[model samples]
Target: MYAIVEIAGQQFKVAKDQRVFVNRMEGKEGDSISFDKVLLTGDGDNITVGAPAIDGALVGAKINRHLKGNKVIVFKKKRRKGYRVKNGHRQALTEILIGDITIDGKKKSDSKKSEPKKEDKKAAPKAAPKKEESKKAAPKKSAKADDLKKIEGAGPKAAEALVNAGVDTFAKLSKKSSEEIKEILTNESSSLAHLDPETWPKQAKLAADGKWDELKQLQDDLNGGKA
Candidate 1:
């Protein structure tokens, strides 16, 4: 038998032993989940439908794993504004298997809610130390932001995004991984989603180290800020 049920704010037509991948959910792998918002059910020649949702219908499912979908590039440019941005997104996904479908069901915990699964999250931020040390370290680490536009791939828009994401310093930009930097530029808050950061760090490293000639050469080799 197959049943159309709603789970995690989406409807799905599921059958026994069938796998279903949905948005990221709270449960870890191997946890069991159920849905009671069955809208329709069919078996042989009989089909049962609900006005909005079936009162006694439930669909059981088991969490197989939680994973990320493919990387999607987002690019934006503004005319005459000298603004261009590029970013990437990877959707968080949860894979589950439909274990059982019940029409006249009573026992099940409705997996009605799921947590926020926004993407492009950076690594967990490091905790701060004592206040005295933090005060002393702040100024030393937080110098005047570098001119990000001086770097090969960093245009005005890309520079603005890097500054907003706390990668304003050449040292800071050089220290970040390509993926992490990419995530920062493409994060929801920034509009510079078209910025490619592949060679950004390399350029930043040269800038941080004050190698202008080398940076110029590298920029000559790059196309649209890529190496």
Candidate 2:
């Protein structure tokens, strides 16, 4: 029997006891690891394919060794600019021996499935109280969301993310620390990961207090919303 599996981002057709070199992987030599991303499996005339990947299927392997591949040289030059660069790179790789492929295996999701579904039954009754609480909280929600873009580093997307996360008003934002705001932005999207929130809380505080003059002065001194 042979199985097609993905390991370290690359796919390979492997059989029992077959050795293959792949991208560097974690774990020491002789460590046994299993790849659950079995795309396809075949046993003579019978073939089983996956929708993306077969659930509960596994390809077992043992790490043989870790080594670097042959180095490749790269040369670059800019004519008339008198600039030249030469570089060499060696790819780190690991040798693994395929052990056995199993079609029926225990999946991580199986345990989650075994978890008692009683929570769903209990959650139904709690929904009514939550509705009543939301009705009572309507006044708080009626307050207009602040234009967080006024803060030096926050953009339209950042403002929208804050609003969705319940930090809609300047008062709410000012109460949060820079680290908290940074975490929020990172959890929202990876594209906003590079934004600096170091000065956000202070700027929000000024805005929340309606000190436009001081906020403008602070923004003028800031470099791209950074201190």
Candidate 3:
């Protein structure tokens, strides 16, 4: 039997005892991991496919080792502008041996089923208040925190810092001056102090106004968030 499954954001066709290399995952050598995102499975003439992913289907594996892939060189040049950059990168990877692929079976990691039942019984009385609190807070928080990573040169950590500083939404970010944004980034961490925010406000303004086409055009002209 063979199963197609997603492991660390990539899909692969695997079977029992097969060794595969995938993107770096959390776990040491000899640790076991199970992937529940089984896309499809086949055995002889019978075949089963999932609508996105099959429910209660899992592919188990054991980590064999961790290593880095071959280095790749990236080169960028702007003709007649005297601008050229070269860099090398190596991707971290993990090797694992595939085990049994099970369908409609209980997961091996679901050992705390009884604990949840006890907690549910105790929390049942206060569920109404918790629901009310969550309902009241969820919309406000979701509406305020825009995906700042959509802006050019903004990464996950930068977006998180901007959200924590109250410049969570595009509208809020649009109002902040470049210098103010720089100060906020610098205050958050010395590592982020090098980021240039000159084009961030302009980009945020376009995003807040829902001018996605214009924003894309502007971003196309920007180099690493610079003009």
Candidate 4:
């Protein structure tokens, strides 16, 4: 029997007693590990596939050793620009021997449900520590959010993103560079990556200085907050 399983975000085809080298896993030599992301399994003429991963399939393995892959040299140059760069890289790898492929395991399905529960549990504890901060920050956020939305290039979603990142006050927003504001909006978890923030700092400066007339005139000259 053979199974295709996911490990460290990469998939590999493995069979019993087979040795496979994969991205470094967190374990010492002789430690045992199991992967439950079995994508497919086959035995003779019988085959099973998963929508993404089979719920009750499991792949077990034992770590033989950890080692560094062979070094690779990387070279880059900009022609006629007198710029050349050279680098070397070595990837960390773990060697493991496949032990068994099993189906109809209750532990495998329970583990999948428990993984999300663990993530939710982790997020819950972090909220308590930030409660006092939320109290202190609450009053300003309400009034500041409306004013932030007035800034060029900062719509409701962009304003909310900035507010969540702690730039709720006009003075605080005014102090940030465009690059800093972009970083705040373009976070990996945020959906505001498509919004441009180039004109935000300038508009914030006007708003913080109580120059609403000037800020409006500047917005009129801008095209969707680009300039």
TM-score for each of the candidates: 0.46, 0.48, 0.56, 0.49
Worst 10 residues of 2 by lDDT: 113-122
Q: Give the TM-score of candidate 2.
A: 0.48
**Alpha-carbon deviation at 18 in model 2, angstroms:** 0.7
Please provide, for model 3 over 176-210, each residue's C-alpha lDDT reduced to its tens digit, 9 standing for 90 to 100.
99999999988886557768999999999999999
In candidate 3, residue 32 scores what lDDT?
Answer: 94
Comparison by TM-score, 2 against 4, better one? 4
What C-alpha lDDT values do all the predictions have?
A: 0.76, 0.85, 0.86, 0.81
Residue pairs with colliding backbones in model 1 are 85-192, 85-193, 85-194, 85-195, 86-192, 86-193, 86-194, 86-195, 87-193
User: Model 3 segments beyond 4 Å from truth?
Assistant: 106-208, 218-227
- In the range 126-187, model 1's lDDT, one tens digit per residue, is 32234358899777755677788887766665676778777788999999988898787677
Q: Pick the winner on TM-score between candidates 1 and 3.
A: 3
Alpha-carbon runs more than 4 Å astray in model 1: 106-227
User: Candidate 2 lDDT, tens digit per residue, 1-227?
Assistant: 99999876578999999999987777999999999989999999989898789888988999999999999886666578886777786778899999989986446556665553565566676666775798889767755777888999897768877887999989999999989998998898655677899999999999999999999998876766975
How much does each candidate deviate from the true structure in C-alpha RMSD?
Answer: 17.3, 12.5, 7.3, 14.6
Model 2 stretches with alpha carbons more than 4 Å out? 106-227
lDDT of 3: 0.86
